[model samples]
Target: MSLPEPRDPSGPYRISVVCLGNICRSPMAEKVLTGELDRAGLSGAVEVASSGTGGWHIGSGMDSRAAALLRAHGYPTDHAARRFDPAHLAEHDLILAMDHANLDDLRRLARERADIGDRLRLFRTFAPDAGPSPEVPDPYYGGEHGFTTVLDMVHAAAKGLTAELAARYGSAL
Candidate 1:
């Protein structure tokens, strides 16, 4: 079945954070964005989630390092890895990818479809500063510091995303 569209008319703003695998960046983005909107009193106004370009991590929990970093930062831990699908082009209004390869992969996956390329967006479009970056940088292989930096990036982008969506749809919904 297709993923449900977000319920908020203003929009649940269905967003799916995507990376090479769901264990690292995308999951962090999903959880971080969820928390950011909640703290901003914009919770449930957006349907936020995460996935991977590949299925390697499907059904796995967030990487232990990722989980620890999130807990360290006081974010939620509910996550399950899944692969990106073509139907996702319709499932989510926005898809934030972690890097150039994944963004290309996502678009390639939707090559037969129309409208999704526009929906597939860089994960950093919502960053609070530094203009924009090409990638969110995968943190699965490094130490806590890499994970921490990922946290910083996702957190920055989440706020910008929240504000932009709120502006278009009115955050009150």
Candidate 2:
């Protein structure tokens, strides 16, 4: 699917990545997408941020395993966990959820706001070869290999999304 138009035509396109908890998938996607956008020359044309559906981990750092994997891959892991505020619906061009559950939570929070609902989608949907299930699985309870697997998924999606952004903003970039 194509990306929604920027909420503010003259401003940088804002995107918010989300998951159950901000410590894992969402933050990883955020950093990977941010780096991809920078590499694609859309660094100043887009703004990326991340949050969680639940408030349990608010103000926490990235999960240790998640942080270590990102660091090993040369991606910055600095993050402050926060809950996704419904009010942010108007502040972003897109809201990407890491899995179906997070997407459902965002849609429920969006409620009657059709404009926001249109902007919400599964993050992995941007992956060029995303299979039948595009959801990025939660790696928190698994082994180190789970985190590595998640990074691979995030990297693929980030690259695809960045390509779309570059196409749309190439002239401006």
Candidate 3:
């Protein structure tokens, strides 16, 4: 099978996982994917990060409970929130969004339709067994369990995503 290099060879091999807000879903996705890659011994080969659809939380660390949840799950929790940039449309090799609205936002930023063609996909599309969960729910306004739920979804999706990456970019892994 052919695996896509999650990262670009000419650069740091970056994968910018994105959601509506950096604090919750996207960061959770980042941690899960990064952790899965780490388990596969591709930690250094995969450069993972998270950003938001809006600028409200830029330069902020993930929520405290979110950090705790990540640690509880034994995944790295370090992240700084930032809004999605138009340049990101060109920067990231793959852009995984939590929902269709965010996908539309990313698509709207594309300078050309081909710029986003087949690149931006729903995160749940890669989930191992999360049935019909199109987007990981935002846990920011809810209680701690919401964060855990988000983590659960993120972890499953990250696993499938990593395996896909390995197949797509066999030489890199």
For model 2, residues 1-173, the per-residue Cα lDDT tens digits are: 77898889999999999999899999999999999988888889899999999999999999999999899888899999999999888899999999999999988888889777479999999898899999999999999999999999999999999998888788583
Number of clashing residue pairs, candidate 3: 8
Candidate 1: Cα lDDT at 133: 60
Error of 1 at 121 (Å): 0.8
Query: What are the per-residue Cα lDDT tens digits for candidate 3 across 56-140?
Result: 8888988898898888878778888999988887777778888888888887787475645677778877886767657877788
Instruction: Report the candidate with higher TM-score, 1 versus 2.
Output: 2
Number of clashing residue pairs in every model? 1, 0, 8
Once superposed on the true structure, which residue ranges of model 3 sit more than 4 Å away at CA? 1-12, 111-113, 171-173
- Can you rank all candidates by TM-score, best first? 2, 1, 3
**Which of the two candidates, 1 or 2, achieves a greater lDDT against the reference?**
2
Clashing pairs in 1: 8-11
Judging by TM-score, tell me the better candidate of 2 and 3.
2
